[model samples]
Target: MRVLEEIAIEDLGVIRTARVPLASGLTVITGETGAGKTMVLTGLGLLMGGKADPGAVRPGAERAVVEGRWDLTRHPQAAHRVDDAGGAVDDDGTVVVLRTVAQGRSRAHLGGRGVPQGVLAEIAADLVTVHGQSEQLRLRTPGKQRTALDRFAGAAHAGLLADHRAAWAERAGLQSEIDDLTARAAERAREAELLRLGLAEVERVDPQPGEDVELGALVARLGNAEQLRQAAQIAHDAVAGEDMETEGSAVHAVEQARRSLEGAAADDPALGEQAKRLAEAGYLLGDVATELSGYVADLQADPAALEAAHTRLAELGALTRSYGSTVDEALQWASDAGLRLLDLDDGGDRVEAMRARVAELDEQVASLAARLTAGRRSAAVRLSEAVTAELSGLAMRGARLEIEVTDSDPGPAGADHVAFLLVPHPGAPARPLGKGASGGELSRVMLAVEVALATASDDEAGSVLPTFVFDEVDAGVGGRAAVEVGRRLASLARSTQVVVVTHLAQVAAFGDTHLVVTKSAVDGDATVTGVRAVDDDERVRELARMLSGQDESETARQHALELLESSAVGR
Candidate 1:
């Protein structure tokens, strides 16, 4: 069994330093109002990584520290989580948890290593369950009610609920995909048609790479054929004489200079070098003249080829206007459009596939939901009978708890809507927990539910129930009802640890271990609260104080002694 071995609180609230030792069975904490009994629970909460408050620190203290040691031999999941957080478990199967609050900031530590506060919270869920007035109110909510029923059904219902949840999620995803495809059907068709038209236009032209640039140069040359021929003729005459006898040409002038230089070559060797250059220049002039003549012969104005080039350019230009600013850009657009068309065309096939999957998931969800409903309905009958019997012992003799599991639309939790209906008397019509039960009655009913759930856990032999802490579970209850609440808590403690913060003497007498929180002025002015386990005479005095207003009253002492005796017999 999971056990909170001990809790130590330092500088927390009015309690300066208190070490509260816990026990495996029922441990009851009681004190006068404002005497700081709740501080015990506050420390436990902090040790469990509950939200920390700097204001909770005692006056003049820098920080508040709360620590707890737990025996986790029976709680492997909690030990595993601690191990995962880098915490070491002792050979005796104990783990120490620490929480410190300072300057409005909180920190948690597992064993000796510092860890995230959330890590402590995660492990705490497997170690303790704190029930207070708020939890009773939560019992009235439909979600909590459904959860309670599912929990009562145990693993069979839980497995089916898990399966249904998976199927529901799959169905939801497939339906969403189908809806998107259907919604965009018209848009996809439009895109496909546009892509097809663009591809066709690009294919019709079939333009080659860089062809437009080459054609531009060729067209310019053909358009200026006559001017080019005239220019070539002038250049030929300047380089060489039109005929061999022509004067004032470069070839005749160079030859005359070459003859004069050769005559002076015998007297000056530099003149011989000049004559050789002139001879080479005349040869180059002859070659140019011949090439210019050949160019003039070949040059012809061909309007047909020019017209064809212009027509091809116009076609490429038309393609560029709609698809791109250039032929290359248009080609790229066509390539991309072809790929996009394939995806758009596949939308229909994708929608059909998703519809088929959605249909398949729908069947799976229905089947699982049906199983979950059947399981819950069957478990509900047992749960109702069990809780009704518990409520009878808690001072509601004829009250019956009716669990109503009705069919509803499939959801993450399955297709059943469960509600806890209470029949307050034998002949009364069963009504919902909120409308049918009084405050005290509701508290008793919640206690009964807890007892039933704990019993269910015991039968399963799965994970053991965590330590239960109830803050004034007997609120609005008195007389024999208070005693019954105590008896129930004591009975629950037989299977697990139960710590109840209470005020009733009848309840306090039933505790196997009793802690009394007392307030006194210390150091002349400072008020301090402290908790200590009381037994025998001290326990009776404490109970006497609870029964009346004075612990020394003979009448109250007698009642306290009788309560202790009766509690012994009851247990």
Candidate 2:
């Protein structure tokens, strides 16, 4: 029972400012062309977050604004969303929505807080559904026709559709996995072979951490062994006297100097200090001589060990060239290859698993699709019967609607191809709505379908539909057909709010509340228009104006009165 309580439009098109009060039943807005009746629908669109046009602003105005107040006690989902967006609902369960268009930009506000325009659009989806001439064009599309049928089918068909969609998604996922695995099978096999060869080589070598570094040092030492031995022998000779020659050796010279200084130590204390230093030098020289002799004895050039070190280093170098620049990097490659090899080995198993899952999903999708087709077939019968009944009252007697559900390849929606066929008269060959119905007939059929869907929704959910706004629903219709369209709208209004913009006197007469848009010059001679509710004799005058060119025509006024009386009786 969501209701639009009020709408305010300012500086939009030809209307400076207008406050339109809405009621619970049928409200028809009527006016002559260029009187700003369409502006009402435009304002409503703005309140619902429709795209704003800068050209819609009045000449001197900087911007345009449209605001609406809604009673949302019955729309808990919308109320919850508002609360989630940090908006407040009034104590009486009402919310304010405003849309402002300025300088090619549009802004939306919920309650008192600014919100994204999409937020208002989301709320509007559950609050109102606007049907205009464009919808008539859409009704001719097969997809739209199918959607209408699903909507009319209510929750049962929706459940089946949901199930079918889930199964289809599962099947699609498995099929994608299978395709990927199959396409890459040969490439993966090659990758696995390379990884296996690398892993085997690394395992055969089995190099330890830092092993390459130790081997490099050993090789350098072995390569320089002969040079090192010669250098050591020269140093030993300089530090200590050679076995056969000791006269000029450093140790003997220091010993003679120490003896000479000891004899003179008694004469001067500085000379005693010098003697002690020379003695320390002699002792250090002796220790160096002993170590030198031992080092020369141990310094045998081992060519075999040197050759082995060189050979081991060459082996490590070969491994580094193929795998990594260093031993650690080569080891890291081996680790990575091992993991990759595992995935490559499991590819066949994964493909088999996907195939099995795909088979399972195929079964589930087929079963769900069958159930969906059955449900649609059942609902199509009820929908056809209901629309047919509605058409009979819309002045199309004996015009039967047939909803044909046929089998098609399974898709996201299901396996049923739903079409609406029209049999214009008894025994008349049934044809698709697009071919069988004229423009006026199609309009009536659309209206009938809406009425049928609304009724079906009410019966299935025990809930009222949203506000239904029909912009010139009686288009291409005249005479009793227009009157019947009005009557149907009036009847739909009994359950929910219905707003219609029309110029037909018969349709306007059936309104529970009638508003007329009038245009005139103001104090400064500027033309402006606004909407106001008209009733009693004023309503009769408005209706008369619609019926004929003159509002004061005696015959037209009489006819308006009779139309009102007849409408009341029909109600």
Candidate 3:
């Protein structure tokens, strides 16, 4: 809606760093070849969320950073973008946006708040629409054509287009389901048999959780039964046998040692401490032996219970081998199986219903396509006539132009296919805009279509046509025709911003805001980096440099002064 407020660059490749302030009128940029004219556009493109290239950074530099700042709170389209992104307007109703590309990443921000590139791009697309000759190459694609038309005719047709797309997606979804179910029919038969056999196998034994642990405990007790019984019998013999005093049984031996130490205590105190320690060990061993003897008396072996435990463990192993790593996992697999089995059983009915629904969606898409085609075809004649009228003022007086709408298969933009066809002179065959139209002709026709489309879309707000940027818009023309080209540009300027990088004084004379792009050596580097607005007298001097490549000549200066004066361009 407005010219860019600021562009800041730092170590952004060869740029090193530069900042520029822009004005809100026709701004002309004139420079020699390779003066970094393209850099300006590239910078704008990067800030608008274009892909970043680390290679764009200067060698040995750590990063490339380009920052663009815009105050767009007053722009309706910009306000809508802010509202959608959950952002608020500033006190001045100005939202400042900054986009940077550095260190192999591109990021954006709004009102100093970080946002994604997608959000910034949405706002940028509305704020600036660049239309250079190279930029126009993007128009050759049919996708671009459809997008522009939908955007130009957005309000009435965008919702219908969305509906068509949703229906198409639904139809695609059902088709995919049918194909998948058809492929799985045979596989399901085999899996169902395996599943049935597996369920029966696990169900017969009904293995419980921790069955293996219980089996392990039983096995240990059974294997140790004999050794444990023998050990308990020997301990019982030592403590309470009939030959109890032979070699002094455990109780009698400890009593003898205690009495001997009591007598020796008068001779040595160390012997007394040793005897006391031996009496404590003898008491603990006697208690454990008595307990073991009772345990041996009650020990019993049951062959049936051991066999049952082993059998349950084997059943659990089978489930673990087939279903999952653990009982919990096995249960989860069973739950999934139940759900899948239900779907497989009822899949036939579901497939049939989806087929019916897909057919209904197909009908809806076809009907919408028919309506769109009808609307486009009906408007073709009028649109062509309007463009033809605007072209006569550009230079060609009797050129023939026609709008062609060919029917096509359903696409995201409906079934209407539109193209602008032209015959440069009478009796010439009509051809598409790019193939037969000359460069100058192409520019004029583009201007005509844009202006007419803007008028037709007057009811819609926030659709500013793209600014026409041309490096050679005035190429190969002079006299009244050159003047006519300026008129055409001025006509376009009424609704769309026009920026022409040209050598023709006639074209430069048409600017509402004239900027001189000069290349100068800064710190011994040959760089084109200066841009400044010029006034009425200054405009004549710059135009003279462009016209005669000299300013000392009175003749060249007079012509330059006339060109500006005749156009009444008081920049």
568: Cα error in model 2, Å: 2.4
Best by lDDT: 1
Q: Model 1, stretches more than 4 Å misplaced?
A: 83-92, 111-117, 187-344, 457-462, 524-529
lDDT rank order = 1, 2, 3
> Compared with the true structure, what per-residue lDDT tens digits does model 1 show for residues 283-388?
8887888898889889889999889988888988898899988778888898899889998998888888888888888888888888888888988899999999
Poorly placed runs, candidate 3 (over 4 Å): 8-19, 32-36, 50-66, 74-123, 222-299, 325-328, 460-471, 475-481, 496-498, 521-525, 552-571
* lDDT (Cα, tens digit) per residue for candidate 2, span 197-242: 9888888888777789998887777688778778778878887768
Instruction: Give residue 333's lDDT in candidate 3 (0 to 100).
Output: 71
Encode model 3's per-residue lDDT on 131-173: one tens digit a residue: 6676455555555655555544535565667777787787888
Candidates in order, TM-scores: namely 0.73, 0.77, 0.76
* Higher-ranked by TM-score: 1 or 3: 3
Q: Sorted by TM-score, highest first, which candidate order results?
A: 2, 3, 1
